[model samples]
Structure formats: structure tokens, C-alpha cells
Target: MTGMERMQMDAAEYRDNQPEAKSAVGEAYEWVESFLVPLLAFLLIFTFFARLATVNGISMLPTLHNGERLILQQAGYAPEYGDVVVVDRSITDEDAIVKRVIGKEGDVIFIDFASGEVWRNDTLLDEPYINEPTMLQYDISFPVKVPAGCVFVMGDNRNHSLDSRSSDIGMVDVRHIMGKAVFRFFPFNKFGGIS
Candidate 1:
């Protein structure tokens, strides 16, 4: 037909002539390099130091959101105040919850509902990331001392979160603190480290 059409047909014919090798050994090696090796490496990495998780609710909105993907880092993790982390409920086999650390072992926690101020061990925490006031009071009252080996956690969407303040998930043990959410890699608009 046309010159351009004829040229395209000739190009397709040339490509068909240079198909991948039919050698079994060569094909197997290529498959291993392209898929098996990388898969094994990923499994090893995830098993030892990291995991992939997704935000499952709106509890952490304005900081992290539902359906956003995260890379949870576990190696050498020490729960620190203000670090957003994933807490596992292995005892119940429930999906993990992501929350921000508020008070650590041996610290006192109090929240003034009227002023929306949170004091940990007599110091007002500088929380510039909270979406709103911490108005949701749980079964446990304030001024409670966190146990010797646990952390008090709350979501950034404080007014509507169910966290350490509630007896339901009170004082998460350090052992149940699975990993810190180090990175967010979904919804290209919010691609970066988890704050």
C-alpha cells in the first residue's frame, strides 16, 4: 500500500525473525534473573527489616490517609514520641493500627479538654501536625502514668480516634510495636516520608 505502511510491515517481519532463544537453559536463567532472584531478595528484606502496609481508615487523616501505601521499618526500632508507627494486635489477629506516640514508659499523660492541650510529663507537646483538638476522652482518665514498658499512642485526627486513651487499646507494649511507618509511596501527590 503506502510507503509508511510497507515500512511498518517490514519492521514487524524483522522483529518476528529475532524472537527470544528457545534454549531451555537460557530461558530458565533469564527467568531466574528477571523474577525469581528479585522475588527472593524482596522476601528476605521484608522478613528481616521491613514490611508493606496500607492505611485502612480515616483515623490518621491530614497526615496519612486510607488506602495510602507505606513501608514499615522494624529493624532497630525504638518507639519515640511523635513517630507514627504501626502497632500489631497479634493476640487477636486483628489488622495493625497506625498511631503517633504520645507518652512513653514512666511518663504521665494528661489532656485538658477545654484547652485542647496535651501534657506529657508536665511538658506541653509541640504538635503541629494534629488536624484538630484532642477532644475524645476514653474510659481511662487523664494524669495516668504509662506503665513501665508501654507507650501511649493517638491518631492525628484526635477528636475521632480510638487509641491509648481508650481501654480497648490501652498502653501498647513495646513488643507489640511492630514497626515505624517510614515512607508513603501511594497517591503520587502524597509520595514521601510518613511524618
Candidate 2:
């Protein structure tokens, strides 16, 4: 082939390779932009609304066991009395404790140190959810009128738990509440909604 024809042939080969090069680059860009962005967004939203926590001790006992993995919801929702909940303890020196809501805003709570009996607004509570009924020893007796925007919480394993009764935990501010433990997803057999 003549020099000019040879040059033309080389130019044609280079032109043919351009689309393949462009497509490879386009595919990479699309992969990062499409998959990576959504994946990051999913992680952010999941971490923001829901999080995974391991039950460290038997504070929850039959309700939640040690080493069990739990899904904690962290959204702003009204919590009813008797609902099991998880609170954020990072703001204070207290450890993260799971507990049951016994009283809400405007309720008066009384604890009889002698019998471990709890009275809400002069009515005794019938708590079948406790891990052990007599395990609780009411050391601190207080007639607290739960303040507005706050909640009174206690653990199911009341004897060993450091919850609202302790000065450290005191009455938890509603704003510090992470969310309720709606379900337990680990230890396959115990995998169901957390009552």
C-alpha cells in the first residue's frame, strides 16, 4: 500500500477503536453514579432510622437474651405505656439499657420499697411482662410526677437493671429515646416481634 493509503488505514483503525474506548468509560461512570449513589443513600437512611444492637446482658432476660441481635427503630413516634424501648445512652455516662415504659408524661408513679410493688396514679400495675415477678427489689422509693415530654422506664429484669430507678438513668427525656425494639432478628428460633 502507498504511504497515504497506509496512513488512511491506520486512521480508520483508530476511529473504530474510539467507540469501544468511549463505551468502557461510559459503563464505569454509570456503574459508579447509579449503583454507588443509591447504595450510599440506602446505608445512610437505614442508619438514620434503624440500627442493629446486640443484647449484651440479661437485663431484658426472657424478653431479650444476651448476645442476641436486635433491630432498633430510631424515628420519632409516640410511645405507649408498657412498650419495650431502647434509649440512647451516649449522651450520658450511663450504659445503653433496654427497658419497659411504665409511666408517661403527667402520670404519678409510686414504688413500694417493701414489696417491689409499683403504683401508677394510685392504681397498682399488673406486670406480666417482667422476667421474674419477685426479682425486683425496690431500693428507691419515690412518688414522681412524670414531667411533660419525659417518660419513666424500667427493665424487665428489674433486679439487675439500672433503669429509671437509679439516679444515673433517672427519668429519660423523650428526646433522648432512640426507638422501640419492635423485633428480634437473631438466634433464628427467637426471631419474631419483641413483645
Candidate 3:
């Protein structure tokens, strides 16, 4: 055989012996298309729609506990009374705390420490989620009206929480809110939607 023909024959043998090389590259491209790209999209969607937070203390005990994992939804967030929410603590403290919205702007809130009854806008506020009586009155006096563009929030564990009732946390500005606590995802036993 001629030198050129011999080289061509060798090249054909090499190609025939290595059938997997082409398939391996095609499989890699398929994996990138099917898995990697979708995973990246999923991550972006997750981060945009929700926030992940860990319960840092027992402030919301009996409802949420320390080290528990939670999902905070950020979409179309409007602060409403009774909604559990995650507040950004930069304006109040070093770390954030989760609490339930008790009153909104212009809502008059008053607590009777003796009876443990909360009054809002002259009506007795019905609170079944609180862990205990509202006995923890802070330095701030009550019959307080939540300021314009602010919200009154309190922990479920009222006796142990520093919340809107306290001067430090005050009325949380709507801007300082991180998101609404929608679900608990950790501690498998407690995995479900939150009120």
C-alpha cells in the first residue's frame, strides 16, 4: 500500500477503535443542557421567590423553635395582622427575629396586663397563637398607635420576646421587613405551612 493509503487506513482504525469518544462528548453536552442549566435556573428562581432563615431563639416557641428552618416568601408581600413575618434587625438589633404581625399602621393597640387581653381599635384582639399571656410590657406605654407606614409585631412567646412593644424594636418600618414567614421546612416532624 502507498504511504498515504497506509496513513488513511491507520486513521480509520483509530476512529473505529474509539467509538466512545464522540458519544462521551455528546453525553456531557446533554448533561449540561438537562441538569446544570436547569439547576442554575432553579437556584435563581428559589432565591428570587423565597428566603431561607433559621429560628435563632425561642421567641416564637410552640410555633417555631430555635435552629428550625423556615421559608420566608418575598413575593407580593403586604403586611397584614396575624401574619408571621421575618424582620430585618439592622434597625433594632444585630440579628433578625421572626414575629407575628399584631397591628398595622393606624391601628390602636392596647394590652391589659392584668387580664392578658389585647385590644385593637377598641375591639378585643383575638390571639390564639401566642404561647402565653401578654405580660411582658416594655418601657413603651400602650394604647399605642402604630405609626404611618409601620407595623406592630410581637413574638408568639410574648413573655420572652423583645418586639414592637419594646422601645428598641418600636414599630417596625415596612421597609425593614424581610419577608413573610410562610412555611417550616426542617425538623421533618414540623414541616408544613405556618399561620
Per-residue lDDT tens digits for candidate 3, residues 1-195, read 999999999999999978688889998999889988889987986778888888899999778999989888886789998998998887545888899999999999999999888899999987888899888888989899999999999999999999988888898998888899898999899899998
Ranking by lDDT: 1, 3, 2
- Which regions of candidate 1 deviate over 4 angstroms? 1-31
TM-score of each: 0.82, 0.79, 0.88
lDDT (Cα) of model 1: 0.90
Sort the predicted structures by TM-score, highest score first: 3, 1, 2
Off by over 4 Å in 3: 3-19, 91-93
Candidate 2 per-residue lDDT, tens place, 36-147, comes to: 9999988996778877777768888778888888887776667789888878888766556788899999999988766778889999999888776534544444888888
Report the CA-based lDDT of candidate 2 relative to the real structure. Answer: 0.82
Q: Which 10 successive residues of model 3 have the least lDDT summed?
A: 88-97
Clashes of each: 0, 0, 0
Estimate every model's Cα lDDT from 0 to 1: 0.90, 0.82, 0.89
Residue 155 C-alpha lDDT in model 1: 94
Which structure is stronger by lDDT: 1 or 2?
A: 1
Tens-digit lDDT track for model 1 on 20-120? 54466688889879998889999999999998888889889899989999999988889998999998886988888999999999999999988899999
